[model samples]
Target: MSDPQHSNGWRRFWHRGTWWKALLLVVGYWLVYQLIGLGTSALFHDVIDVADPLSSPASIFFGVALPILLSGLLLIVLAASLGWARGLFRRESLPGRRWMWLAVLLVLIPIVLRLIGTRWSAYAVATVLAILALGLCVGFAEELLTRGFVVNILRSGGYGERAVLVLSASYFAIMHAGNALQGQPLSTVLGTVVYTFGFGALMYLSLRVTGRLVWAILLHAATDPTTILATGGIDAHNAATAGTSGLIGVAGIFSFVYVAFALVAIFLVTNRTKVAPVAPATSD
Candidate 1:
C-alpha cells in the first residue's frame, strides 16, 4: 500500500479537511460501512435475519452489533492513518459553549426516564450484553467519524464554531441516509435523518461542554441500548415491545428536544476561546 502521509495522496487531502474533502470522506465512509454490512450479513446469513434484526436478542447481536463492531474497527484504522488518534481524543481547541449542557440534558432526561420504565428481564442476559456492546460500538464509530475526524478537520481549516456544529451535525444526519438502501420505509428513513440531525448537534455539544470526545462517545453509546431496550425497537420498528406505564410514556416528549435544540443551537453556540491552546497532532 502507498504511504498515507504522502502530501498528494487521498489521506493527506482528508487531513486538510476542506468542506468538499469532508464531504468526500463522508461518502467514502458510507460506502465502506455499507460494504462491510453486506459482507457481514452474508457471512452470518445462516444466523441473522436482516428483515428484522431486532427480532430477537441473538439476531441483534449477530446482525446489528457485529457489523457495527467491524465498522468501528475500520474507523479506528482511519483515525490512525490520518494521524488524528491523539488530538481527536483531547480537549477541544476551541472553547465550549456552557449553555449546550441544556441540549445534552434534554437528550439525557429521556434515556434516564426510559431506563426507569424498561423491563430489564424482558431481554435475555446475552442480549443485553450484546446491546451494550452495540451501543459502545455505535458511539465510537459515529462520534469518531463526525465529531472526532470531521470536527478536527474543520477546526484545522479555521472554520468558526457555529459552522463546525452545523456541518458536523449535518454530516451525522446524512450518515443515516443509508437506511433507505436496507429496505427501511422512506418515512422511517426521513424521520431518522431529522432525529439524528438533532441528536448529532447535541453530541457535538456534548464534546464541547465536556471538552473531550470521550463524553460524546459515552453519551452516544448510552443512547442506543436505552432506545432499543426501552422501545424494544431497532431503527423505526419494534417487535417484542413491552408495555410501559410511568414516566416512560412521557419520554417521547423529550425526544422532540433534539430537533428543537438543533434548530436553536446554531444561533446560540459560540467559542469562548478562553482556554490556552494545546498543540494538535498533525494539524488535527
Candidate 2:
C-alpha cells in the first residue's frame, strides 16, 4: 500500500489550486519584470539619454528584449523544475467550426497589412523589428505564466471551464495594471483594462478551440504590434504624451471595437454544440 503521508505531501505540492498559484505567478512575474526594467534602465542610462528607452534599437535590445528574454527563460526553468512541462507545452486541435477561423483571420490579416505598410527610417526599421521581437517574448512569457500555468492548475484543481476562463482572464487584466506607471492616463488605462479583459476572454476561448499554447502566443505577439502600429507607429509615444481626454477617446474607440469582436468570438466558441474541455496531460 502507498504511504498516506507521502501521498498527501505530493498532493499538496501539485494541487495548490488556482488562487495561491496564480497569485504567486503574478507577483513573481511582476518582480522579474520590474527588476529587468530597473536593471536595463541603469545599464542604458547613458546610451538612451531620452526619457523613453524604446526609441532606438540598442535601447530596445537591452531595455525590452533582454529582460523579456530572461523572464521567459526563467519561466521555462521554473516550468521544468516544478514538473509543469506537460501542461505548459500541451497541444490540441482546432475547433470544428469555420467561423472560428474566420474570426482569427479577421484579427490577423489587418494587423499583418498594417505592419507591412508602416513606414520607418532605415535605423527606425531596426528598432521596429526589435519591438516586434519584444512583443513575441511578451506573448510567450505572459501566456505561459497565465493560460499555461494558472489555467492548468485551476483545471486540475477541479475548476469548471467557466470558472477557469473567468479567473484566468481576470488575472491577465489585473496584471496589466502596471502599465499605469508608464504614464498612461487613468481613463486610457481603465479602457485598456477592459479591453485586455475581453482580449483575455478571447484568448481563453482560443486555447479551448485550438488546444495549443503556441497559437495563443502567436496571436498575442501579433496583437501587440498591431496595437502599436494602429495607434500611429512606435515613434508616436502616445501613451507618454497624448493628453488624458484624447488618449481616453482613442482607447475607448479601440477597446470598443476589439471588445465587441472578442465577445462575439467568445460567444461562438462557448456556445458551440460539440465543445469539450481539453484536459492537460497527467504525466509529470
Candidate 3:
C-alpha cells in the first residue's frame, strides 16, 4: 500500500497540470522581464533607449546583470517558499553524465572563430562579453522554468522524454524570434533555432547522464555568450538582407560543420564512456 503522504502529494501534483503551471511561470517571467526592461529604460533614459534593447546600455545592464542577480535570488526564494518536494528553482533531478568537454567545445568555438577571421574590436569585445553574460542569464531563466521545472513536472507525471524534449526545444527556439524583428533575418533566426535546439539536446543529454542542472546551466552560459561574440556588433543597419549574403556569408555552411561535429563528438563520447543514467531523485 502507498504511504498516505505520498498519495496526498501525488494528488496535489495531479491537481496542478504541468503545462498550465509552466505557461503561468512563463507568463510571470515575461511580465517581470517587461517590468525590468521598463524600469531600466526609465533609469537610464539619458544614456540608453528601450527601443533597441541590444544597443541600449540600460537594456544590457538589465539583461545581463539584473536577470542573473535579481532573478536568481527571486527564483531561489520562491523555490524555498514552495517547499522541498517542488525543489524550488533547483533541478533536483538531473539524469546524465558530466560532459565537461562539450562545454569546452562551445567556448572554444567562438575563440577559434576569432582566431580564423573575426577581429576583436574594442566595442565587439565589450559587446561580446556582455552578450555572453546575457546568454547565461537568459539560459538560467528559461532553462529553469522550461526544462528544469516544466520538464521534470511532466516527466514525473508520465510524459514521454521525446515529446517533452521536442515541446521544450521548440518553445525555446521560437522565443529567439524577438531578436529577428531587430534586424536578425530569417536565415539567422533559423541558424539560431538550430544551434539553440542543439544546445537543448545537449542539456537534455546532460540531464540524462548526470541528473543535475548545474552542468547544463554552466554549459548554457558558456555557449550562448560566445555566439554573440561570433556575431560581433549589434548593428542591424549593417546586417545583410534576406537575399544578400552578408559579411559572414559562411554562417550557413559553418553551422552545418558544427552540427556534424556535434554529432560525431556525441557518438565518440558516449561510446567511449559507459556513463549510467542517474535516477531523478538523486540526480540534482
Best by TM-score: 1
lDDT of 1 by residue, 218-268 (tens): 999999888888887777425456437566668777657788878898888
| Cα RMSDs, all models | 3.4, 5.2, 6.8
- Clashing residue pairs, candidate 1? none
Best of the two (2, 3) by TM-score: 2
Which runs in model 1 stand beyond 4 Å of their true positions? 1-11, 237-239, 243-246, 271-284
Error of 3 at 38 (Å): 1.9
**Candidate 2 residue-wise lDDT, 222-242, digit = tens:** 877655644443324454322
Candidate 2 TM-score, C-alpha based: 0.77
Off by over 4 Å in 3: 1-17, 49-59, 63-69, 84-94, 97-118, 124-129, 178-195, 234-284
Q: What's model 3's TM-score? A: 0.64
lDDT of 3 by residue, 113-192 (tens): 43344434524445556666776776677666556655654554454556555555555555555556556688877777
Cα displacement (Å) at residue 38, model 1: 1.2
